[model samples]
Target: MSALQVGLAVAGGLLLGGVIAWETWNARRRAPRQPVPERRPPAPEEGERVEPGVASALPTADDERLEPGFDTAPGALSPLGPVPAPEKRPRLDALIDVIAPIALDGRVVSGDAALAALPATRRVGSKPFAVEGRNVLTEEWEFPIAGQRYDALQAGVQLANRTGPLNEIEYSEYVMKAQHFADALGGAPEFPDMLHEVARARELDEFAATHDAQLSFTLRARLTAWSPGFVHQQAARLGFTAGAIPGRMVLPAEEPGLPPVLGLVFDPRAALSEDPEQSAINSLALSLDVPQVHRNARPFGRLRDVAFALAEVMDGEITDDTGQPLRTEMIDKIGQDLAQLYDTLDAHDLAAGSPQARRLFS
Candidate 1:
């Protein structure tokens, strides 16, 4: 080839390569930044012992199960990080529920039979209606599981909850469901007197009303509004994860099955937007359902700290539900009040974060 032609060819190739590189850089610059996953510490060079870390993104379709780090019990720690154990829900208690015994004709029922006979909804007029069987082998009360034989079964409905005390209608519905449940299993249910249970429910409800305390603070953008990505990214840095619902992020409790320690919620529409980056979010709420979290988790402290931190990072101002900007003194006062409330709950034996408290508040 001629020298002139060769030179021209070389220049053409260089120009094409430069254009491709420029396009690649520009595309990346325009693309929304993704969350940077919090990497877990490396395992002891032995092998793949999945040491789960803070979840940064939703699990892919192929994920085998709720990624590990949740099987551990509350407050329990491991070498890697906090492995919040899944909570084994509390069983039936006569103090909190109206109990009824099901006579199984002295005949042990198979687990499948018991499960099949239980009520389908597991709820009776805003109260939790549940059935538990006495394990034939261990004599322990539990929800019937496969491969077990049950010698006895009991049904109960919660006496009171945040919604208020169980009334006559709810008690009657409980009775009907429990009776039907027993009949389906060829057994008979002996329920407590509706009047007595209703009275007990009212008393319990009064006590719960005095103790229940849920705190929330709104974080409003001070100057520049934030994108959904900015909010989520900041929360993730503070050990938050994407919750099941949109616009909701949570700092998971040390106990897995229990409700989250603290929750942050903004605009659900923004979360549902086709391009979250383009959505501007001006305000979000940080909340703590006091009774739902254990005292040891220091949920109140975390709520306060997170609110302050987010406000600082996101250039926001913290305010009450009434929209009045909260000063530091106001926050401290609320903490003091929370402490007193905790004392009250503890005195009633429904200490915050206990299963009973969680159930009652819920």
Candidate 2:
């Protein structure tokens, strides 16, 4: 109730209010707050100024296009562009490089005559010897064996492995044979390096590997529809002889030292009926296995003719491996391809179906 007591109470209340306000302000200042994020500049447009060493990291329009014959993966860049593949060589060519030829001269007689006079008992390695011929009137001789005729005068006898290179023993035996032939002909024996010939052979072999092709024509019929005797008769008319196998008939090679190019195959395992009139043939396959280096157009033409004849006689359709009917245009196209191959071989002085080609390609 005293005036001094009332004034003391008011001062106490005022002091309490001021202390509470100060405490609230201190709590708010100590509380944690979220952090602010940083911002980056926008990328420059094409032709715009960019920092040095930074432009190389950016992609260009050409990076999206791929080079020819090149394969690329997604999200990856190839450091080097497409590279060409290396060429392949034949195994025989490398083997022939170490070989040399042993030559025996025929003084007065022809090379062929001297070669033919050689003793049958004499063995000059497993490989056959090739004879080089010269004109009786002129001293010059043909370079290629194909251009020379069988009746040409014999000048020298060469014991070399035209098909493959000779080994140590084989080379020694060939040298011995050359010496013997030289003594018989009363002339000196000479040895020549075959590096040039070996190089030519290699080129021919590579060409063959690139262009080799095989064609087959098949005729299918119901089971027990062709008799073996009838098939043999038909084949005989087409100049086909029974092969080593019972069901196989092969066309004879046009020249000696060459293998058969075409063959007729029949299924001999088919059931046979007791009736003589019934047929026992199942299927017939006509195949032309042409040599890559020595093939000519004649073989392909003959093959087509024989296929047509057999198809007509058997009352069957000619088809490919996929059983699709073969059209005449397809066969004509094959013939054209064969002609082109022959021309290419001839241009390189390696005529197809020639004796030299046969010997080298063998």
Candidate 3:
């Protein structure tokens, strides 16, 4: 072969080999094989269930135990229901229980206005009376303290006698009488060796004459010292009224040519032994001829009247039973009424000590 022919023939052979290699490469790329999926384990034989235990998975009685007859379902109530209803509370009696502290066969006492005007006495002291259904009893002074409650009212009276415009002789007589009363009853620890300052006064014919005729001088013995502060005022409000003595040896304060020494006589035993609050409230109702409203009753015109009456009595502005200057020592009674009124207002959320009430004294 010639040199040129040999070179051309070599080139053609390389070209043909290249074309055949390209076709083979293209066919291999287009027809490449895919990977096989993973195989799972073989299924179990028919009716061949695997048993891990012999009924050991079931819950025992202890697992779901509950209270007797108790329902475990959602929102279920227990079989043990509430107890049966208790007996109803008894109703309050109007005649017997309505009177509370005041009762028949009771004595009525009295005191001065300034002596009875302390508001603290009303708050700190006992109710002096309660309306437990209807049976009233005025002997509640020893309620908070064993029989020492009278001392508070007596102290109040003494304070009024000392600071107020009451005369020295009268004040002294009042204190002495109180001391004697306490002594007769056995003196308190505070007033041990207490003497009856009013002994001499009581011995005076005038004292006997002016004192309650139904009660002997010995009854005065039962009477503790009640100047104003030293005793409960409730006793007085429902007890005594200002007026001429009906048939006593003494004349009334309004009586013409009456002795100045014979001040008004206060007899606490005159009224029924009832709660002074209820007594005052009832008496106030009677005084105004109004109905007895509950303590929570509103529109306090009746209460206002009671307050005004009380304030007038306290300020010595209230006329006596006979339309004369109020000479009877009845501030104790007024204070009792006031305490009830205050309690009533408080219970009802009423305004306390209304303007008319204040103006009555002013």
Weakest ten-residue segment in model 1 by summed lDDT: 65-74
lDDT of 3 at 171: 44
Q: What's the CA error at residue 44 for candidate 1, in Å?
A: 20
Per-prediction RMSD in angstroms?
10.5, 33.5, 40.1
CA lDDT, every prediction? Answer: 0.81, 0.52, 0.28
The runs of at least 3 residues in candidate 2 whose Cα sits more than 4 Å from the true structure, single-residue gaps closed, are 1-126, 132-173, 184-186, 194-200, 209-214, 222-224, 234-262, 267-279, 289-298, 320-330
Task: Write one digit per residue (lDDT tens) for candidate 3, span 286-361.
Answer: 1211112211122122222333333333322334344343332453464355456556444533223222111111
Deviation of model 2 at 283, angstroms: 2.5
Superpose all Cα atoms of candidate 2 onto the true structure and report the RMSD in Å to 1 decimal.
33.5
Model 3 misplaced regions, further than 4 Å: 1-155, 158-164, 189-362
TM-score computed on alpha carbons, candidate 3? 0.16
- The candidate that achieves the highest lDDT relative to the unseen native structure: 1
Between the candidate structures 1 and 3, which one is better when assessed by TM-score?
A: 1
Winner on lDDT between 1 and 3 is: 1
Q: Each prediction's TM-score against the native?
A: 0.76, 0.48, 0.16
